[model samples]
Target: MFNPSPKQFKFIKALLFVLALLPAVRLLVFGFTDRLGANPIEFITRSSGDWTLYFLCITLVVTPLRRFTNWNWLIKLRRMIGLFAFFYGSLHFTTFLWFDHFFDIAEMLKDVVKRPFITVGFIAFVMLLPLALTSTNGMIRRLGGKRWQWLHRSVYAVAMLGILHFWWMRAGKHNFEKPILFGTIVAALLLIRVYFAWRNRGDGAAKSRTAVQKRQVTPTLT
Candidate 1:
């Protein structure tokens, strides 16, 4: 397997950092050029939300890809990719809060309570907040590896919430295409993790049983 040196890994990360920001940059360019269609707010909101899902999908895919390809360096990029997911999620939420609600907290609360899609989206964004805040190495050390991993596992739930949000929102318009596709991708990514975990547990159990059998069969030492 070809392992990336530190410098090569940094270069890859830098390239991905820029590539990930392109969606936000495109939104900016479109806004400046008055190309956000007739409903600028809706366009911005949808675009940001779509990119959030895309990033989430990419973030979730990283682990499976790394394991399958044996490119351990790919794990280093996961934090950045995950943060980008949160970044676009922030943008998506900001559009709804700033443009849709005009910072009216009461109205926003009412909307969230009244609409199931908005409710799930609000919860998903709120869930992402903690994950993003605790993404740093310092935070990981502070939380400890096991605790940090447990907390970060909420990301799977967040992705599910995000899919539900999108699906419910599109239900009103009878648009199932994109929602179904995103749901399938997220579901498959999550199931891949589950499968590996189960297989590893089985492998460990088998090893333990083999060791026990060998010990039982061996003659006792004097």
Candidate 2:
């Protein structure tokens, strides 16, 4: 039901790339026009942070979508979407580092220590670095498939930490609708992954048992 030619896929990918940038581009336009609300820093920071979570959710959905729909092509887009998650995450962290701390490494460290929200966010951002660095084909080949998969599994932890960070940050304001919504989505995606893994294991075990039973019966017949 979902088959696209090479040219069509290329076109679609290009379209997604441009659409992904639209948020940042929109922020730039707002900044240029002095329209980022009264507190521009807060506006930009929140916008970047929101997009980071959004992209993370989108990245996590790729597997479930591909598996359930049988559209393998969705896997091709996961890397790009994951990189965008990192991109926005970097922007979110940079906003705090440059604007909030003014290049003061000491102060940044202090904030990470003194502030729980910053702490979780920093941890999450740090975890994204390795994933982004090793996202290339060459690195994957060097790391081998199993090791690479293990390392990239950090995305799940990063997703949880990110939600916690966002949740804590919003706690003071008593606004939790967004965090709760995204947290539910991430949780559902993770649970779906676990269910599929369990199902595969069960299927494999059943197949092995059946093969063994057939071997025993064949010896008796002979």
Candidate 3:
């Protein structure tokens, strides 16, 4: 019912593509300029992780925004946003392994097991891997619609774990501002989906009742 012209769709895609590259571009510039401030590795790690979560939030918002705006073209950008989220997430993980742990698998595994925040973050990243892998059209087709949908539903859990990771990481400092903001955004997105699903079910029931009423009226007419 909601469709965009070909030209409009192309423009939207191009805009999103440019937006997705901005973070990587900034990272590169900062690296070259040695401008990472105080703790360079920590700066890069936190920046990438923040962008990953932000993009994930935006990706989740696409569906609800599309429904509200009646602009189906927004759906076309969802995959790109999701993949970019994974891209930043990979960078975040790499910064930890390469810069922090110096590729020390044993130490990293030990931390993952011992630290609840890292444990949750590691689990969230693992969950995102499959979603990123199946972002392709061919993979989606191969997985079949229902199965793919089920697998992607893990995003909800990923979001929850991500917020928990952020929350626990900040627990020592008692600073809840950033995590609270992120949590609120995730909650809003989830609530939108819940509301729409319930509304759709009601619509379906009403349609069924209408059909039944038509059948009963037809018998009387006969």
Candidate 4:
């Protein structure tokens, strides 16, 4: 019932687009100016990848937010947010492949097999590719609503894999703080979804009971 004006929708899109670009802009400036401290490549790659996971988590939160807030307009931004997540994620993957591996296919393959963190991260990126490819309106129509919904549920798995990747990557340095924070945010978002789902089921049951009671109480005309 709460529909946003066309202007409001456009503004929202623009704002999110700008916000999504800010990180990349910062990274580019840092790279060009030689501003990355210590390990520049690692800093850029991790920062980009972290933002990608952040966006992915935020995109996942949109559904539950819409339902809980009853602000249906939020649905309009989910696709945009999701695609941005993929964009950042692609950049993250590319940075690692190009900067770290230097396009060495053999070394990259060996690293994936040897490092668990890389393995999970690679798999998460692979999962995101199909989702990004199908983000268009045409793909939605072709896949149909139900099938598309099913396919996109892969984001849940992607999120878990991403967190695991982050966690394991940090484990090497014995720095659990950042990964724990990310895991906490993701877990909180997921718990919100679970709570709302249970609440909706209860509301549905109550509505059904009320309808049945009303039917029983009504007198037949004949």
Candidate 5:
């Protein structure tokens, strides 16, 4: 209903691209202005991680929004929004590696093993890596539609892992509010997809039964 022309769609996409980067730009501005507060590294880490989760939520919402609203153009925007999720996730990871461990792989590995939250976050990031790498059109062609779709479905797991990582991280400090809210949103989004899938499967089975009944009736009538 609110469809845009090709040129307008491109402009809208470009605008979304700029808007996605605003969080990162804000972080840089804050750093330069010394507004990151007493614990700058921790502040940067938390802020970037929060934005990563926010983008993930937004990316997950796109499909459901498109289905309910019939905005087919939203699919075109999904790739960019998903990539932004990876971007913020990478930034969050970089903050840990650069500021927290100073690029010490051994120490990072040790911490990843030692901390449950870090382990979950590490696995989530590792899973996100392949998704980002195979997001190109060429890769999609190479992987084939079914396989590519199967691979991308892992985003559901990534979303769950992200929530678990955040929950565990906050467990120590007893800060459960934000994590609970995010987890609920992610859970609801996943459930919507699951419900549609289940309903479609039922519909397919019902149609098969009707076809069988029609065949039997035709033979008896004959």
Candidate 6:
């Protein structure tokens, strides 16, 4: 009932694409202007990692928001936002791999082994690749709707890994503020998802029992 026309939806999507890139663009501008603070590499790494989590949190809440508001149009933007999460995540990993390790495979592997935060961060990025690859309609068709949905549910795992990564990274610096806040948001989103899933399952079970009860009574009436 509140659907936008094709043209309007296209425009909305175009606007969202630009909005999604604004963070990266801002980071780039800051880098060019030398506004990324004393340690530019650390600044860039933190900023990119922050944005990836921000996008992941935003993407996770989309469904809960849609459910509460009944605004189906919100879903149209979910894919775009999820991809941006992966985009920022890629940048974050590249910053670590290229700038931090200078493409040293052995060094990167050793760092992953030595650093708990980096290990989880690496795992999260690896999880994102499959989701990004399977995001297209073609891939969805190939995987079938149910399978696609199941695979994409891995986003929850990615988000949890992201939170763990952030928490451990911040713990080293004694900075738990942002980590706790984002963790709360992610927890809320996940709880909302579980609540709905359980509610729907209960509703389905209730319907089945009602149908069976009616069938049992029908023969007596005959």
Best by TM-score: 2
TM-score per model over all chains: 0.91, 0.91, 0.89, 0.86, 0.91, 0.89
Cα miss at 108, model 6 (Å)? 0.2
Expressed as tens digits, the lDDT of each residue in 55-96 for candidate 3 is: 889888987897899765667678888889899989999998
Please provide the root mean square deviation of candidate 2 (C-alpha atoms, Å).
8.0
Task: List clashing residue pairs in candidate 2.
Answer: none
Residue-wise lDDT of candidate 6 within 11-98, one digit each (tens)?
A: 8889989988998999889989989999988988988999999999999988788779877677778888999999999999999999
Cα error, candidate 4, residue 214 (Å): 25
lDDT of 6 at 67: 79
Best by lDDT: 2
Total clashing pairs for each candidate: 0, 0, 0, 0, 0, 0
Q: Model 4: how far is 196 from its true place, Å?
A: 3.1
After superposition, the stretches of candidate 1 with alpha carbons farther than 4 Å from their true spots are: 205-222
Instruction: Return the TM-score for candidate 5, rounded to 2 decimals.
Output: 0.91
Model 1 collision count: 0
Q: Please, what are the lDDT tens digits per residue for candidate 1 over residues 77-145?
A: 888889999999999999999998899999999999998889999999999999999887777778766
Superposition error at 61 for model 1 (Å): 0.4
Better of 3 and 4 by TM-score: 3
3 or 6: which has the higher lDDT? 6
Q: lDDT tens digits, residues 1-222, model 4?
A: 767688877887899889888999999899899898889988988888899888988988887777678776777788888888899999999888898889998999899999899999999999999999987777777876657777887988899899999999888799999788878877888888668556655777888566445323221100
lDDT of 2 by residue, 1-222 (tens): 788899999998999999999999999999999999999999999999999999999999987887789776777788899999999999999999999999999989999999899999999999999999988887777876667777888899999999999999999999999999999999999999889767665787888566445423321110
Model 3: ten consecutive residues of lowest lDDT: 213-222
Q: Report RMSD (Å) for each prediction in the order shown.
A: 8.0, 8.0, 7.8, 7.9, 8.2, 8.0
The superposed Cα distance between candidate 2 and the true structure at residue 57, in angstroms, equals 0.2
Quality of model 6 by C-alpha lDDT: 0.86
